[model samples]
Target chain A: MKLLEIKNLHASVAGKQILKGINLTINAGEVHAIMGPNGAGKSTLSAVITGHPMYEVSEGEILLNGKDLLSMNPEERAREGVFLSFQYPAEIPGVSMVNFMRTALNEKRKYHNLPQLSATEFLRLMREKKAMLAMGDKFANRAVNEGFSGGEKKKNEIFQMAMLQPVLQILDETDSGLDIDALRIVADGVNKLKSQDNASIVITHYQRLLDYIVPDFVHVLADGKIVETGTKDLALYLEEKGYVAYN
Target chain B: MCEEIVLKANESRDIVIVNEPNVRLRISQEEGSQLRLHIIDWQSADNDVHIEQVASNCVTEIYQVAYLKDNQKVTTHTNVRHLVGGGVSKQVLRFVLSEHAKGDFLGTLYIAKDAQKSCAEQSNRNLLLDDTATMRTRPQLEIYADDVQATHGATTGQLDENALFYMQQRGISRQAAERMLIVAFLSEAIETIRNEEQKEKLLNTIDSIL
Candidate 1:
C-alpha cells in the first residue's frame, strides 16, 4: 500500500521558492534514496514534510497514509508516524536523553491509545536500544545531544528512531558528519529497524550510504523536482557521473 | 542594623519576604541552626542584605529571584560573612528582565581571618529577554583564611532562542515555551528548598503568574 504521496508540491522559505512542483510516492517495506547536490532542495523537502514553521507550502498536497499531512502540526505529524531525523539534531541542555526519549515515546504511545510504559519497562527498552547501537549507559543520563560527539549524536538519533518506531522515517543527511566506523554502526541500526510494516527515506549527497542501506529506488532531486528515477543502478550512475550533467 | 536571632539547635526556620524600596536586612546565624530564606522583589526597588555565620556547624541557604517587566529598575546588594569554622552557606540568585527593565547585583563573600574549613558558595545568573533589557553583575570574594573554601560565579545572558524554537515547533505555543524556559532557569534555586510542599507551591504560583 502507498504510505506517502506528494503531488506537485511547492514550498518556500522566507518567501523564496525552494521546492517547485515536486512529486513522489513511497510505499511500505521500501527504502527510497533522495540524492541531490547543494541547493537542490533535498533538505527543504524533508523540512516541508515535517511541517517546519519556516517553510510555507504554497501549493499541492501531501498525504500520509491517505491523510492530509500538510495540515497537521509537527508533533501531530510525528505522532501520526512520521519521523524526521534532523540534519542538525537540536541540542537540549538540562533535558536528559532518557527523559526526552521516554517522554517522546510515551507521547506517541498515548496518541495511539496505548498504555504508558512503566519506568522499569521504559528503562529496559532504552537499555536494549542503547546496546543495539553500542552506546554506553552514561549517554542515558546526559543532556539530550549536549556535549555529544557528532557520531554519538547521529547514533542517538537512530536510537530515538528505534524507540519511536515511526511508520515513515526520513533520514536527513544522517551520514554527513559520520566517520566510516560510525557510518557502519548507524547503517546497521537503520537496517535492524527496518520491517515490512514501515518504510524509510534516506536523504544524502553521496552513494556510500546507499551501498549499505541499499535503496529500492533512487530519485535524483534537482532544482526542487525529482528529475530522474531508477533502481539502485541510478545511484551508481550518479556516483560515476556527478550532478553537473543532471542539472 | 544587625539583628541576632537564636534558632535553638536542630530547629528549622523558613523566612519569606518581599523587599520594598530601600529595604535593608541583616541576619546572624547561631550554632547548629538551619535557615532557609527566600527574597523575592518584583517591583522597582533597591535592596540590601547582609548575612553572617557567627556559630559553628550552622546551615544557611539563601534564595533570591527577581522578575521585572516594563521599564522597571532594580538593584540588589548582598554580603555573606563566615566568621566561624565548620559552617556551610549557599546563596543562589536569578533575575529575569524584559522590556526596558534594568538590573544590577553586587554580591560579596568574606571568609574571616579565623573562619577555618568553612564551605561557602554564591551563584548569580541573569536572563535578558529583550534587546533593551540590561543587567550588570559583580561577584566579589575576600578569603583571608587558608583553610576555608569559597566560590562565586555570575553570568548574564538571554534565553536560548533555538531551544525556544525547538519547543515551539513541537506544538508547544510560544507562551508555553517561555514558561518552560523560565521554570528551567529557576528550577536550580527551587530545588534547594528542603520543604517539598513549599517548593511545589511556589513553583505552581510562579507558573500561574507567568
Candidate 2:
C-alpha cells in the first residue's frame, strides 16, 4: 500500500520558485533515494514534506495513507509519522537530550491519546535508543547537540529517529561529514530499525551511502524536479557520471 | 520597602524571593562574609538591591529571573560597591516578556580606590517574545582601583528563530518548543538553587507557566 503520495508538488521560499511541480509515490517498506547536486531543491523537498514554515506550498497535495498532509502543521505532520533527519540538526543550548526527546515522545503520544510514559520507562527507552546509536550514558545528560561533533550530531539524529520511530523518515544528507566508521554505525542503526510497515527517503549527493542502505528506487532530482528514476544501479551510474549530465 | 541588612564577618547567607511585590534592601558585608540571592518575579514588582563590601574578603552572588506576561511590568535596579580589597561580586539577571508586558533592569558596579584585587562581574539578558513585549536594560561599571577587574554586559532581543524552527521540525509544537527554549534560556539562574526540592518546584512552576 502507498504510504506517501506527492501530487504535483510546487513550493517556494521567500517568493522565489524552487520546486516547480513534482510528483512521487512511496509504498510501505520501500526505500527511495533522491540524488542530485547542489541547488537541486533536495532539502526543499524534505522541508515541504515536514511543513517547514519557511517554505510556501504554492501548489501540491501530499497524502499520508490518503490523509491530507499539507493541511497539517509541522508538529501535526510529525505526529502523523513524517520525520526529517536534518542535515544540520539544531543546537539547543540548554535543553537536555533526555528532556527534548521525552517531551517530543510524550507530545506524540498525547496526540495519539496514549498515556504518557513513566519517568523510569522513559529513561529506559532513552538508554535503549542511545545504546542503539552507540552513544554513552553521559549523552542523555548533556544539552541537545550543544557540543556534539559532526558524526555525533548525525548519530544523535538517528538516535532521535529510533526513539520516535516515524514511519516516513526523510534523511537529508545523513551521511554527509560522517567518517567511515560513523557512517557504518548510522547505516547499521537505520538497517536495524527498518520494518515492512515503515518507509524512508534517503536524500544524498553521493552513492557511497546507497551501498549500505540500498534504496529500492533511485530518483535524480535536478532543477526542482525528478529528472530520472531507475533501480539501485542508477545510483552507481550517477556516481560514475556525476549530476552534470542531468543538469 | 527599603531595608538595610548586613552580613557579618565570615557569615554566609542565602536568600530567595518569588512573586514578591516590592524589594528594596541596603546590604552591607563585613570581612569574609558571603551572600547568595535568587529573585523571581511574575507580577508588578519594583526592586532596588544595593550591596556594599565594607571589609576585605567579602563575596556576593546574585541571580534573578523574571517571566512576565500580559501587561505585567517589573523593574529591578542593582548596585554593588566594593569598598575594600579582596572582594568578589557576581550577578546574572534574565527576563522574559510576552503579550505587552514590560521589564527593565539597571545594574551598577563600583570598585572604589584602595579596593585593590577586587573583582566584579554583571550580566543581564532579556527575551521579548513578540514585538509588543518590551525590555530595557543597563549595565554600568565604575572602577577606580587600577588593580581591580570588572565586567558588565546587557542585551535584550527576541527569541532565536533558528532554535524555534529547529524544535518545531523535531515534532515539538512551536509553543512547547518556545517554552523549552525559554526555560533553557533562564536555566543559568535556575540551576543556582541549592535545594533540590525547591529547585524542582521552581522548575515545574516555570514550565507550568510557560
| Top candidate, metric lDDT | 2
Model 1, residue A140: distance off in Å is 2.5
Taken in order, the candidates have interface RMSDs of: 3.3, 1.0
Q: After superposition, how far is residue B134 of candidate 1 from its true place, in Å?
A: 7.7
TM-scores of the candidates, chain A only? 0.99, 0.99
Winner by DockQ? 2
Tell me how far the alpha carbon of residue B184 in candidate 2 is from the true structure, in angstroms, after superposition: 2.1
Candidate 1 lDDT by residue in tens digits, A1-247: 9999999999999989999999999999999999988999999998898788889999999999999999887777888888877778878766667766776777777777999999999999999999999999899999878898999989988988888888899999999999999999999999999999899999999999998999999999999899999999999998999999867
Backbone clashes in model 1, listed as residue pairs:
none
Q: How close is candidate 2 to the true structure, as a TM-score?
A: 0.96
Taking all chains together, each candidate's TM-score versus the true structure is 0.77, 0.96
Q: What's the true lDDT of residue B200 in model 1?
A: 88
Error of 1 at B112 (Å): 11
